[model samples]
Target chain A: MSAPSQDLLARMALTFEAQQFLYAEARLLDTQNYKAWLELVTDDIHYWAPVVESRERRHRAGHYVAAADESAYFDDTRATLGMRVARLGFPGAWAEVPPSRMTRLISNVEVGEQGAEDIPVRSCFYLFRSRLETEEDSYHGVREDVLRRVDGELRLARRKIIFAQSVLTARSITTFL
Target chain B: MTFDVSRLVDLENGLIDRRIFSDAEIYDAEMDRIFRRTWLALGHESEIAETNDFFTTWMGADPVIVSRTAQGIKVMLNMCRHRGGTVCRVDRGNAKLFLCPYHGWSYNPDGTLKVVPGLEADYRHGIDPTQWGLLEAPRVATYKGLIFASWNPEVEPLEEFLGDARFYLDCLLDRVEGGTELVGGMRRWIIPTNWKHAAENFVGDSYHAAATHASIMRVPGLEGAGGRVKDVVGYQAALDNGHGVGMWMASEDNARGGYGHLAGIDDYLKSIQDQLVAKLGELRATRLTPVHATIFPNFSIEFPFASLHIWHPRGPLKTEVRDLTIVDKAMPAEMKDMLRRHCMLRQGPAGTWEQDDMDNWSQTTYSSLSPTARGLMANYQMGMGHEHTRDDIPGRIDNKSSDINQRNMYARWAELMAMDPPPPQVPAACRSHSGEISR
Candidate 1:
C-alpha cells in the first residue's frame, strides 16, 4: 500500500468532525432540546425546504424543483425558527401536547466546497416519528447545509432539505430535519 | 344508487350523524352522488397557459390529466384504454402526446387516440382509434381562471351552481384588474381525517380557531391574526347549493391587522385601493372581504393568504389536502413574496396553525370510528333559527360562530345522495365530435 497523503488525512478528519457534529445535533433534536439545538445554528441561519414535485425529465429546467420564490415547506430565518421553538412550550400546542417520539438517523455525511470559513456538507436523514398510539410516519430526505465557523465554533449557516417523496405522507413536519 | 339520508342528516334541528364521517357506504355514495354531479376544481388556467401544457390531478379516486390543447383545456382519464396503466405519470409537463409505456398506446393532447404500436402488423388495423381514445369528462367549465369539471352531462351550469358565491369568490380572484395567478406549484399532504371535516371546517367553522389554534396566537407575527379582521365582526354566509363563506365586513380596521397579520400587505392594498374599488366596487373591495370559503363538495379558498385548497377524498378516513397559493398578477414581486411566505408560515403540512388543526381533525375522525360514537348525533345547533336573510348580503346570513353553513352543506349532501344517479354516458372514444355515440 502507498503511503497516506496529507490532503487525504485532512479530508478524513473534516469528515469525521462533520459526522460527529451532525450526530450530536440529531441527539439534541431527538431529546427535544430545541434550545440547545438552536445554539448550534448561526443567528442568520437560512433554513428552507422547497416543495418537491414530479415532472418529466425533459421539463426539468425550472419545473421539477421549486424556485426561490415558489412554494416551500420550511422557509425560516432564526427569528421565525425561534417562534416555532417557542410555540412548543405553550400550553395550547396540541400537536405536540403529547409530544411525538422521534428518532433521526443521519448518515452519508460528505463534504463539499471546503472554504476558509465555511464548508458545505451533505447528508441523508431518515426521521421516524410516532405519536398518539398508532400514528407513525417516516420521512426520508437529504439535507444540504453550509457550516460556518462562528467565534471558532461550528454553526449551521444554511440548510436546504430535499425530500424524496413528491407528496408529504406525514401529518405535520413538527420536528426539524 | 340511493342512500337513506333521512336518518343520517336531520337538518331541522341542525343535527348531523357522526357516521357520515366514518361510514364506508356514505363515502362510496359521495363519489357517485356528489363528486360525479358537482363541479370539481382541477387547477388554475395559468397552470396550463401555453398550448399542450398539462397538469395531472385526481377527480375523486380516479386519476386525471388536465391539459391545454390548441382547441381548449382538455381533461381526460389518465388511464390507458388498452390496459389500466397511467399514461402521463408526472405532476406537470408540456406534452402534446401521452404515450403509455405499457404497450406504446399514444394519445393526443385532446385525448384522441393518436397511434398504436404494431397497428398494421399485430392487429391489422382491426381496432378503430376513434372508438378507443381516452375517456374525458362530460362537462368542463371555468369561472374566473379556475377550471372545474363534472362527469354528469346534465349537471347545472357552473355559474348557476356557483350562484351568489361568485360575489365572494371575486373578492379573492378578481380583486385587482389584472386578476390572480397561482404563484408556483402546489403543496400537498395527507391527513387522516374525513374530507368533509376539512370541507366543513372551511365552510364557516370560525368557532374552531380559538381552541384549535390557541398556540398560533402566541407566535409573534401571527398573533391575533386570522380570517376575522381585528375589532370587526364577521358573518358566515350559507349560500345556495351548499356553498358557504365567512367574511368580515371590510372596514378601516382591515388596514391595521387583517392581511394574515403580515406587516406590508396593508400598505400594499392601500397602494392599489383605487384600482380595487374600481374593479370590485365599494362593497366587494372595501366593505366586504371574504376570509375563507368553501364552494360546496371539496373546493375551498382562504383569502387571507390567497391560497386555495382541494380536499381530495382519499377514502372514508383520509384526505389529501392539495394547496395552491394565488397572487394578483398586477402585484409587485415583493408583495407576492410576502404572501407566499405568509402561506408557508401558516398553512401547509408544516403550518403552525394547521398543525394543531390536523391533530384535532384526526382525533375527531378517530373517535367517530367507534360504533357508539357513530350512533350518537353530532350537534350542529349553535344558531339554528337565528339564520336570517340579509338584503345587503346575498345568502342566508348567520353569526360567524354559527353552524348554519354546516347544516346547509349536510342538507345539500342529503339532497344529492337521495337522488338517482344519471345514466352512464357513452365512452368518449365511441362518441362523435358532437358528443353523439355511434354504433
Candidate 2:
C-alpha cells in the first residue's frame, strides 16, 4: 500500500486532539471541578439533554416523544450554567452537601468534518455516582458536541446528551453529564 | 387489611404517626380507597387533540390508556380482557387500534373489542364484542382542559369535588381564552420518598423554601436582589375535599406570573390585562397569584413555573414524579417556548430549586424507617390556631407558612381511609352504544 495521504494524517491528528479535549472535560467533571469545567465551555454554550420516551417504530414521525424544541432535563445556556456552578458552592445545596463521588468513563470518540470555526465530535459516556455509603446511580449516554477554538484553546460550544433510559431512575441530576 | 386511620393520622393534635410513611398495608389501602375513588388527572386535552391520539399512564398501580375518539375522550385500563396483557405498550401514539402483543386481540379507540383472532373458528363467534371490551373508567370529566377520571360511578361531579379550589385552578388554566396546552412531552423520575411528601409540600410548605432552596435565592431575581430576600407573604387555603392552595399576595411586578424577572412575560400579560379582568373578574384576575397547589391526593400545580406534577406512588417508600409543562394557547410561539425553557431553569429533575428537594424528601422517608424514629410523631403545630375563614378568600384561610393545610390534608386522608371501598359498577365499555348492557 502507498503511504497515507497528508489529508488523512491531518484528520487523524484532529481526531486525537478532539478525543483529548473530551477526556479533559470528563476528568474535570469527575473531580467535581465545576468551575474549571465551566471555563472549558464557550461563552455561548447550549447544553441540552432532552427527555426521551419509549415508542414504537411506526410512531417515530409523530409527537410520541420529545422533539427538538420540546421538554428537556437540562436546557442550559452560559448564564444558567454559571448559576448551577454557583449553586454547587453553597452549603445548603443539600443534594451535593455530602458531595457524591463520581467517575466518568468516556469512549468511542469520533470526529466529523473540519468546519471553519468548529468541529463536531461524538463520544459515549458512563457516569457513575455513589453517595452516602450505598446510594448509587449510573447514567450511560452519547454526547453529540460541537467543539470550537476560542483564544487558541478548544472549548465546548454545544452539547446534546442522549440517554438510554426512558425514565430517569436517579432522584435528582445535580451534576452535569 | 384493616388498620386504625385515627392513630396513623391525628390532625386534632397536629401529629402524624411515622408508620404511615413506610407501611406496606397502608399503601395498599391508599391504592383502593384514594386512587380508585378520587378524580385523577390523566392528561390534558391538547395531548390527545386529534381523534385516535393516545397516551398510556398509571392510575395508582393500574396502567391506563387515555385516548381520544370521534365521540370524546375515553380512559380505559390498558390490560387486555383475554389474558391480562397490555394492549398498548408504548408511551404514546395515534393508533386506531391497540393490538395486544401476547395475543392478537385488537381494541378500538373507544376501548370496544374490535377483533379476536379465531372469532369465526373458535367457539363459533360466541363472544360478544361489546361485553368483552376493555374495562373503562365510569366517570370521566374535564375542568378547563385538564382531563380527570374516576373509577367509582357514584363519585361526585368534578365541579362539586373541586369546590372552592376551582377559583385558584382557574388562575393557572383559564388565564387565556383558548385555555392552556402542555409544551411537548413529560419528565419522569423516581425518588425514594412517600408521595404525600410531594403533595403536602406543594399544599402549604413555602416555609421550607428558606432552608431547602437557599441556593436558589442567590440566583438573580428568583427571591430578591441586593441582599433583601423577600419573606413569604401569602395565604394558604384549606378547601373542602382535601384540596389546598398557597397564593402569594399579588403585586404589580407579579402579574407577570409571580416573578418580576420575566420582563417578556410581564409585558405579554400586561397587553391582555383588560381581557384577563373581563374573563376572571377584577379581583381574581389581578389579585390572586397562586404559587403552588395540590388537588387532593396527587395532582399538583406550580403556577410560576407553569407546570403540573403527578406524584405517582411507586410503593410506600418510593414515588414516581411525573411532570408536564403548560403554556397559554394565546401566547406567541416564541413566548410559549421561552416560558417552557425558563421553567427548566428552576423545576424538573435537574432544576436548581427542585434538586435539593429530593434530598430532603428521600431522607425524610428513609429516616422514618428507623426503630427509634418510629416511636415519635411528626410535628404540624406551626400556625395551627391561626386558621380562619376570610370573606374575600373562598376557603379556610391560614398563614402562608402554616401547617393548617397539612393538617387539613391529613384529616381528609384519614376520613377517606376509614371509609369502605366503593363497590365496582358495570364498566361503561361493557355497555352498548344505547347505554344498555350488551349481554
Candidate 3:
C-alpha cells in the first residue's frame, strides 16, 4: 500500500533465496538423487509428521489436533533417514518399485522469526506422484522448517509436516514430503 | 461371478475360494453373520479414564462411541434418536452428554436419555421419555484394558471366545507390572483392499517376511530385538473361535531369552521377569514371544511393534486400517518414546514392512476378481493336516511356516457364515443406563 522500504525489500530477497533452496531440494528428489540431497540436511535433523486426530471444531478446528507424545507417520533422526534413504535403492522396496514419478509444488514461502542459530520458514506443498502406469497419488500439506546456515549454505534442522488429507488415499506412504 | 457362501472355504483340502476376496454378496453376508455377531474391539479402557470421557471408533463401518459411564464403560451407536443424524461428531472428547444438533436430544454417557428440549409442550400422546435413548451395543465387555462389543446378545463371553489366544495376548498386555497404556492417538488410514487380506496376513502369513519384506530386513541396526529376523524360528498357534497368534522367536519353550539388543531393553526386561512370573505364572509369562496376532473378524496386534490394528471393512473392496501403539505403563519416558518410534518405523501407515504387505494385498484384491482368477482357488496347503496340540502350551500348535492359522480362521469363518445370522437390529431410541437393549 505504501512505498517499499529498504529492510522489507532485503527480507523479500532473503525469502526468495530460501524458496530457491527448497526448489533445488525438490529437484534433487525428482531426479531421485537422494545421495546429493542428503548433503543439504543438517547433521542433527528431526523430520516429523504426526498422526493427526479428527476432532471437533469447538476447540481445535478440523484435523488440526496432532501429536503430543504419540505415534507419528515419521519421527526420524538423521541416522534413521539415512537408512531409509538407503532402503529406497533396494529392488525389493515395493512402495518405491517402478520408481515414483513425482513433482513437488512448493508455494507460500514465508520466512518467520530468525534466531541466533536457526531461521524458521513456512510453506505449503502438493506432492503429485505416479507409479507403474496410472496409479496416481496426491499429497497436499504444510511444512514448517527450521533451517540453519552451515558452511554458508542452508540446511534443514527440523521439519514438521501437516497434511490436509485426513484419510490418506495412497496405499503406502513411502515417498518423502 | 456368483459364489455360494457355504463353499467359500474348504479347509479339509486347504483351498480358499478366490471369490471371497472380491465378491460383493459374500462381504455383505460376512457383515451379517460375523461382524454383527462376533465381539469387535472398540478402544482401550485408559482412553476414557475420567467420567464423561469418550472415544469414537468403528466396529466395521458402523460408528461406535465407547464412553466411561458413571456406572462403567458404555458402547452406543453414535446416531441420534431424533432424525438419525450423527449426534456426537467429534472423534473423542470429555462430554457430559451427547446433544443432537438436529433436535437437541441429549443422552448421558450410559446411553440414558437425559435431556429433551421442550418435550412436554410438543408431544400430545404423552410419549414416555424413557423410550427415547441411545442405541447401544447389546453386549459390551472388557478383557484387560481392551473394550469389545457385539450386537448379538447371545454371543459367547469374551473370555471364552479369546480362550487360548489369551495366553499369547498376555505376552503383550501383561508384560509389565502395571500393564500397557495406549501411547496417544491412533494412526487411521484407508487402504484399497479387502479387509480379509490384512486380517489373514496378520493371522497366519509369516512366510511372507523372508520374501515380501526382504529389503526391510537389510536396514542397519534393525536385527529387531533378540535377533527376531536373524533367528527365524518360532511357533504359530491356531486358537479357537477364529483367533490365532504367531510367536516368532527361537525356541519359545522357556520364559527367559534375550530381551533384545537395545541398550536398556535387556535390563528393563530382566527387572520385570520376577513380576511377570508372579502376575502370569511361568508358562504364559515366558512362553509367549513378541509377535503378530489377530482376534477374529477384524482385530489384530503386533507385539514386536507394540501396535494394534482394526481392519474395518468399508466395502468388499476397501478397508479402513486403524493402527495404535501401546507401551507399558511403568516404562521410562525414553523407552516409551523408542517404542513409539519403533511402532511407526515397522508397522504404522508409512511403515517399512507394512508397505510391502499393502502392495501384495492391493494386487490380490484387484486381480482376484478376474473371471479366470475367480474360478481358481487360493492354496493354503503348507503343512495342511500337520496341526498338533501342545498340552503344556494352549491351543493347536503348528510350525511357523505352516498355514494352520489361516486354515483355522477360514474354517471358523465358514462355520460362522453357515449360521446365516441377520444384520443387527437396534431400537429406535436410546438404550437404558443399565446395559439393557430393548426389543
Summing lDDT over every window of 10 consecutive residues in candidate 1 chain A, give the lowest-scoring window: A56-65
lDDT per model vs. reference: 0.86, 0.84, 0.81
lDDT of 1 at B138: 85
Tens digit per residue, CA lDDT, model 1, B1-439: 3446898899887788888888888888788778877889898999999999999998877789998998898889898989768999899989979999999999999999999999999999888888888888989999889999988899999999999999889877887777888988778889999999999999989999988888877778755344435566789999999999998875565543445466677778778888878887766666676888999999998888788999999999999989899998988999899889888878888888788888888988888889888878899998888989887778999998999898888889899989865555656444347543211
**Which digits, one per residue and each the tens of the lDDT, describe model 3 over residues B1-439?**
2556558797878899888898888887788778888999987888888998998878766787889988888888888877687878877888888888888889988888888887777865366667767877888999888989988898889999899888888877876768778988777778879999999998978788887888877787544552233334678888899988887544544336655555566666677888878877776555546478999989998887778998999999899888888888999998888888877777766787788789888889988889998878899898876778877677788888789999888988888888857444555444455433321
In candidate 2, residue B274 scores what lDDT? Answer: 83
- Which residue pairs collide, candidate 2? none
Model 3 ranges with Cα > 4 A deviation = A1-3, A62-64, B226-232, B249-255, B284-288, B428-439
**Least accurate stretch of 10 residues (summed lDDT) in model 3 chain A?**
A59-68
TM-score between candidate 2 and the true structure:
0.94
Candidate 3 at residue A79, lDDT? 86
List all candidate RMSDs to the true structure. 3.1, 3.9, 3.4
Interface RMSD of 1: 0.9
- TM-score, one value per model: 0.95, 0.94, 0.94
* Top model number, TM-score: 1
Off by over 4 Å in 2: A61-65, B221-232, B250-259, B425-439
The DockQ figures for the candidates are 0.82, 0.76, 0.73
lDDT of 1 at A49: 92
Instruction: Give the winner by lDDT: 2 or 3.
Output: 2
How well does candidate 1 reproduce the true complex, by DockQ? 0.82
